[model samples]
Target chain A: MAMYVVGHKIPDSDSICGALAIAYLKNQIGEEAIPTRLGDVSPETQFILDKFGFTAPELKMSYAGEEVYIVDHTEKTQAPDDIDEATVVGVVDHHKLGDLTTSTPLECWIRPVGCSNTIVKMMYDFYNVDIPPAYAGIMMCAILSDTVIFKSPTCTTADIKCVEALAEIAGIEDYKALGMEMFKVKSAVQGTPTRDLVMRDFKDFDMHGNLVGIGQLEVIDLSVFDEIKADLAADIIKLKEEGKRHSVMLLLTDIMKEGSLMLIASDNETIIADAYGVTVENNEVWLDGVLSRKKQVVPPLQDGFANA
Target chain B: MAMYVVGHKIPDSDSICGALAIAYLKNQIGEEAIPTRLGDVSPETQFILDKFGFTAPELKMSYAGEEVYIVDHTEKTQAPDDIDEATVVGVVDHHKLGDLTTSTPLECWIRPVGCSNTIVKMMYDFYNVDIPPAYAGIMMCAILSDTVIFKSPTCTTADIKCVEALAEIAGIEDYKALGMEMFKVKSAVQGTPTRDLVMRDFKDFDMHGNLVGIGQLEVIDLSVFDEIKADLAADIIKLKEEGKRHSVMLLLTDIMKEGSLMLIASDNETIIADAYGVTVENNEVWLDGVLSRKKQVVPPLQDGFANA
Candidate 1:
């Protein structure tokens, strides 16, 4: 039987390339595994897949099965159906452990790295899976997207090493340039919907008595953002009410120039501080060189929340 | 031993409450598996989670592990570290199956229902998991979200049954109000960013000889979308050029009483017509409730292209 790999909803660079890596590894190890895209392919994702000659997987919803192979997420706030299963194949993750089961004899791999593609590079090293230059380029792209080239709050030493190796394989000197190019493609609106323009791939978090939601959007011509700024805020307000969270944060990362220009429309700025460590400049968040929320923002904020 | 339950990213009403049902079932079976959120949470998700008193899940990258479990999502992108040694426990899921394998004995329950939560409710039925009235409300919401209350392209017969049962249990008579409330909460984008007001999540599909990125944005106020309409075409052009794709198709889904308002600003109007059976009108797309690109639009366009 072939092993299948599915990425999350609205699969980002990490989820996409990393799934390819795992499937490649399975193929290397005599397992039939195919990489698939699980959600609607965003423009950003399409950029990389097409550039690297890979296709996105089909849409796949989450199960929360009895036996789950937790990837880069934690288990806190996880429902029973999130993972209710008898068999788990593997878990390649980069976030804090929410509530990993302590008793299972599972090969659990949770790293503080930025992207799972970093782990895939490790598997390439440990398992000796041959890395095609194109695939390597994809993995490197995933790394840069996840870690923002080690600029995120979630980056670890492992993430850096993975990028270095994948970069070597891809024969690229500047990952930042590549990443900038990738993000820049998403810049500005010619005629895209505001809903589509606003980043929707969000995850839920909580602060002190505050339910939080964060969305990362990348666009060029930051001026265009100012034009539709109110609409974005309106969307956030709707999100806040719909998510039933007290706060919603949307970080618009500009890889072509300075750090991200954050658009935070929340009832409390403290939650913004907790999530981004950046203050609002006229209702817009200005984070210092933070490209990857997981690497540069999530860990510190999560830790700060724990401490706070 | 505690059971492991994994759910989908954005942990919607379906996944969260469905996760609860499976967790309750496992508890009845003397196993404690927890449902985990897969990725970032959205505002709508937070709303659903809080409405039922479920905390948001910690963010994760992916879930790929042997002997692991999942609920809403089943296709593994990246495996959790080691799966060969880990004993497969049990599984409850509601997504189309993909690479799911275990070297050892594993019990994986996969369902092709519309929502994983529906599957969990099924387990609730069999295991006699005590359904809290609050949870019943959440499950009803999940069913509504997944089935679009019998309006979505992905809906199945089982989704209707699950929602019907949950509605009865939750003592909900007028789902229209609940749905309207939810829609109001999501569609009310009075303060969202211009970019966000247009499109948040999108995908790329082939239209004629060019690849187009299509995004759908939902909003309640027609006036809010007024100012940014012009810039949308320019932005889509910029994005297409940067991403090296041609023809970005955008649809501004007006979720209010106005029905759906579409905007197509691509050089490929004929392409859109080739894909979507309806031709473009006034450089904008006009569809009579054809939303599903996968099921409704793509197939016809594919046929058109083949015929062409």
Candidate 2:
């Protein structure tokens, strides 16, 4: 039976590209794997795919009674609803360990890096498997998207080295220019629905039994959301009630400014207030130097919830 | 600060040698690491270390406020009681994923292999670090012990290949003779107390909130335990009550016969009877072709407990 390699819901560039690259690598190593996605591709990812001459992964939701290789994420909230029924054969992730258990041994390659593709690149080198040019191009774009063009705090030396190597294979001379072009597509939110923009890069976490939702939107300029902050806030409030979550937050991150405008809708406001030692005024706060949610946002919120 | 590399409480050959080899590899990569043991060294492991001219690892129980790398086991039950207070830097395991979660990303290398030392051997190759001859000799012995001289079902091509490569590095022409010599030392339970014999290779598990204890003793001849079966049964009963465990079972495995005589004392005997579809008489049953506790025993018992 072929194992379905899939990534988290609300898929981003890393989630999509990592699945495709990992599935390809597993197939090269004599394992039958099919890359699948849980959600629609974003504009940024679509641009990268078109530029690299690769097609989008097949969309799949249910995986009960099938074997899976999870990439990019390990949390149950981000997985398919019936993930407990599926057998996870392996996991290649770059996130904190989440609540997943297995009855058998598995191939687990988890590292603390900026992007999952960095670890996937290491796996390709470890197995002595050559990456195709298109795959390398797509993977390089994933690292660029994840690390915010090497400006995010999560960016590491491994990520930079991987991107440089991948760019050489991709025959791209100005990868940073390509990254800016992709970000230009991602920054366009004028006609997008408030809910769609919020759900694009959203993730839910179980913090001390409390369901907390967090979303991020990266753009070249933060001023674009000034006209729609109220709409985004209203949709975030609706999402909190719809999901029965304790809190929902969205980060409007400006790449040029290297900061975020955090919008909050929560049952307990102090959960966010005490986490970063900042005041939440008018349902929002400007967090200076907050670009990486996995590094700067989730950890403090998790600690705050633990205390609560 | 130097990270401490340690293993499970009941230190087996794989556990001890894996800690040593991983710590050595980490130090070679410019990280300070010290090998530590959770309990006293076993006779077989001590024999191998002495033959390889290596000292036993330091004995330490508490790891509060320390950074440590866990090897051989990932279970909270098998770890130190104060493990929650410590920071787990990484884990290199070869068992089913137990209930261990981290708040930060970690370097995890968990594979479905025969021995933790087999995974450690791969790690050495991954980092391009050369293993010392003494370490290679001990690691080869660990693979032999865990795989029952390549007779256990858990043994795979990877495990055999690792042992062969390690033997050449250790300058050992006939490693099978060394394995036999080690087994002779392991089979001597004549003068040991029944309680000591039972606790030598024992581990406790949390099965759906029910505490279960399982121990294994491998020998060339099963008849050596014939004279002490009743005494062993009494000790198991005492252990169950003392630890407030739901059950305590011991496996007297005959490596030559490729079977085990399971002596169980449980609050509900059907937990064992239904797991393997056997009839228990006088707290004793014979299991044919049951060699690996992890592969053949734990999964079935886990299922039975889940149903219960």
Query: Second chain only: TM-score per model?
Result: 0.69, 0.99
Model 2 docking tier (incorrect/acceptable/medium/high): medium
Give me candidate 2's TM-score against the actual structure: 0.97
True lDDT of residue A217, candidate 2:
97
lDDT of 1 by residue, B133-236 (tens): 77787777877765555675556787887777888887888876777677566665556665554444455544445565666654445566677766775677
- What lDDT tens digits, residue by residue, belong to model 2 across residues B214-272? 99999999989879988999999999999999999999999999999999999999988
Residue A186 Cα positional deviation in candidate 1, in Å, after optimal superposition: 2.9
Instruction: Compute DockQ for each candidate against the true complex.
Output: 0.01, 0.78
lDDT values, one for every candidate = 0.60, 0.92
Q: Ten-residue segment with the worst summed lDDT in candidate 1 chain B?
A: B75-84
Scored by DockQ, the top model is 2
Per-residue C-alpha lDDT of model 1 across residues A1-308, encoded as one tens digit per residue: 45456555456777777777777777887867666654667776778889878777644454433233434444333222333332345566665433333112233344446677876786676566789988898988888776655566566787787778878888888887888787676564546776666544565655434566777875544675767778877888787887787667677776545477667666666755755556567677677666765555555655455455
